[model samples]
Target: MTPVSSPYVPDVSRYTKRESRAVPVGPIQIGGGAPIVIQSMLTSDTMDTGACVREALDLVEAGCELVRITAPTVKDAANLRAIRDELRSRGCPVPLVADIHFKPEAAMEAARWVDKIRINPGNYADRKKFVVRSYTDEEYASAVARLEDAFLPLVHLCQERGIAMRIGTNHGSLSDRILNRYGDTPLGMVESALEYARICRKAGFHRIVFSMKASNPRIMISAYRRLIAVLQELGPDWNYPIHLGVTEAGDGEDGRVKSAVGIGALLADGIGDTIRVSLTEDSVREIPVAEALRALVEEFAGAPRPKEALVPPFDPFSFQRRHSHRWVRNAKVGGGEPVRVAVLEENFAALESASAGTEMVPELGYRPGMAEEVDPEDPATLAELETGAPRLVTVRDGCPYPPLYAFRMLAARIPSRHPILLKDTFFPGEKGDPLRERLNSALQVGALLCDGIGDAVLLRREADPKKALELSYNILQATGNRSFKADFVACPSCGRTLFNLQETTARIRAATGHLKGVKIAVMGCIVNGPGEMADADFGYVGGAPGKVNLYVGKKAVRFNIPQEQAVDSLIALIAEEGKWIDPPRS
Candidate 1:
């Protein structure tokens, strides 16, 4: 499939949910300007009808609008009937979804019992051996015909039964055809899903949602933006609601930051209709995080004041770090250096006392007042920029636009070679509510970092510098801008998980947490493990109930290692690859 080019970047000047065809999932509607829906998948076994019912009730009780359960087999798909029946009897009328992969028969069976069916287009009808091959035009057309035959049956079943579908594409699971055609790119991810979507569209089935999920926050954000642009080019009727998530976003604050940066960045501009904060922890715990992210972008409902029209100078569908010449002797804040941390000299005096145990030292301690002030609302400031000597610049305070857009406006007008000091608080010396400050900083500043706009970041008026430093570094790591510690990509636990994901992830972190720059993926199952951690250097994935499969960049080197011995083997594998180091004695 070829990508259609369109000048359809989200307007950063204000926040408004993107309009889409309303997709009815049971009693609730997604998109068409409906309230952003929150959903999560069940982690309990589908065969355990009692467990499944209990889990569904818990999610519904926690305010989850939709619940998804994995149906990897026909038997598992059939059991959804019992699960649905039990939930209805218990007065829980929440919608149910069947998560299907590589199984059309199971998807068809699942369509009969659930309100929605989510099929990975990579596996719906196409084969993926990760082989290097090319498809001739006729062969490619034949493949599309095959996909049509396999997918339209379920589309017809769904249309007839008043069911919805999500053509959810995973970065790690593209078909050989798509991979050979588009490589492993954001375009590839979009095309993979659009092929199936076109099949549905031709059959007059439009009750569909689309998602482009990747573990990398940058990739996840870019793919969603690209997906929207393509949809716009396709026509107005193709306004399908988007499902936003960063798959295998790990757990805890790390997971939250990853989810927020990728999903929140889009949410700031009103791109998602529904969201799932994928975490490696409890599925129920995901709801409140989703709610918080949903609320954070609510201010976008209207402009605080008249704002300038959005005609950004950067590409929204791809990340190209804003070019800047090295301005500092340390070369830490520009000219291809990792984004630096900063504490303005005025704030430094206050933060120095609270910084006893913190390792972070701002690279530039000069007062922010000393930098060139770029007023975002004024185009004259942008045109005045000179690229001769590298200048340190920061957005002027009281700019009508939010940080995400303000910096975007700042970035558009500046000499591309000047380093920018990204600030968390635009107001100087005012200690606002800590929670609000944190959310604004994480969502707004984090979004800019993902856009490759920041060269240095500071939580300008944050009450606690220690906490601010922690949050700043985490955001940088989450956005793939820098890594100060060992990184991980872990999927939220689901019914298909073969082993105890939470406990295993804990164990892996305990042993490998100190390996800075080494990214490890802990997956509960093979379904998404190999492909999901698109960036991890090593992998610990569940091969079976009592077994583990260890990988070195998607290649399984050790299979069925006893669960008890898996960690040791994984460590040995890391050591053999010359990527392991003894943790510093503490």
Candidate 2:
């Protein structure tokens, strides 16, 4: 099988969940045709059993079916027993998962306590020293054998205990071997997880799930799609429950949108069994967002799927912007320019005063007859692009399919020469529910953006034009298609976190949000900090309880800056790197 099977056909449609093996995590089921499960990680320290128990209970109470706690060390793994006993003694049967990294002994200890053990293949066997070297086939095989030896103990322990395992691969943490071979691409992430899975398959352990997580939605989406393709190629017995997440997704609206874009996009494509929305907020806060995303999936799960032969509209496993013609000749609507944003011309003036010198300005205005209209649902409209001269084309209003699927069809049918004007969400542009608007924009448009579609986005129906403009930019930034200001990808606090993630992320944003095109990562600890924040130009990671580490990309240049001086030092690093810019005059 290839990254994208030419004329690939999935058994399910964009509106259904793909059938997968149901791995039992305690009393709950993850795939094998089960409802999409919602999960979150506890931010409380593992040694603080009371705090862990309280947070786990809060998450379960808020409808989290599964809870994960980080056990970075053997001692932390041992504390899981206390946390579990306390939770179970209090009548809480919510399934617990041990999040393990860089320690096989810790995973073995954790397997004895939790219902499921999630091992990051990137770090479970190999420490990431960012070593870049070539390895011959013999050396690679030896490394794989060593990895198998280290991982099999935990696999056997999980199987013997009749528990489940999650082979969760993080994009930023691929081992030196995989990185040298695949260069941090989605294919590498899938292979990293598969190496461990193949060993489990050999050991006759079928109770397993898999996840390919990255802070970037494009990578996360592509990696999971590639995983599904490989699993299908491996045959029926290899079907495993898949876990989904966009790690280091920051706080509040922006974070939620980032999560929705990645998770909602795949869920809409009939992928993913369990999901976690990692936000830099309270652990319990993540539950509602995950539930909301799951609800969006189930809402369309029953819709009739298309029966025609399905060819992926674009390359499913790559990040190349589709080759759109320079049809909007007068403007930067196509020809590989950054995805443009447009708002209704009438609504733009209303926000004109507020939009000045900020992110509120839209790149183009949606006047009545600015472009040729192409109804995404109509097969005949697709032919119009070829019949006439190449020009800017937008989806006509009232397409029956959801925007995610509809836009995909448009992308599949339209000529490469015709530039697309994405008209997201077919709702009224009136003051109503803001959450609805945000979700629709994120789920519909944000999803497509990550898929390398949509040359320009027009939020025509959003009542608030300023919000429409901001949402458009947020979607673009979240997908790594464009950046209007400093972009943040922060992990939700976990037991492994050494400092206050929520407070620190907010402070970092306040200090540096003005620097356009600069990306900073605010991480709680090293577990996912160095790897997950690989895309950030500068990194602010929690080094210890009261110390912070600053990084330039994956390289940590500063060991431990005092917590109070960390932000200042980070700013200085930015200045030293020549990325610091003065905030605009008010």
Best prediction by lDDT: 1
TM-score of 1: 0.95
The true-versus-predicted C-alpha distance at residue 136 of model 2, in Å, is: 1.4
lDDT of 1 at 569: 98
**C-alpha lDDT (0 to 100) for residue 353 of candidate 1:** 65
Give a tens-digit lDDT track for model 2, residues 1-586.
1454522136323565578877888999999888889999988888999989888888888999999999999999999999999988999999999998888899999999899999888898885888879999999999999988888888889889999999999988898899998888888998898899889999999898999998888888888888888887778887798899998889988898889999888888888899999988988888878877887775567655554534567777777777886655335788877788877777666666677888646667678678877775567767667766667887677555677776777777788777788877654554544665577678888878876788888875566667778888888888888878898888888888888888888888998999888889998888877887867889998888899999999889998789999999999999999999888888
lDDT of 1 at 256: 82
* Per-model CA lDDT versus the true structure: 0.84, 0.82
lDDT of 2: 0.82
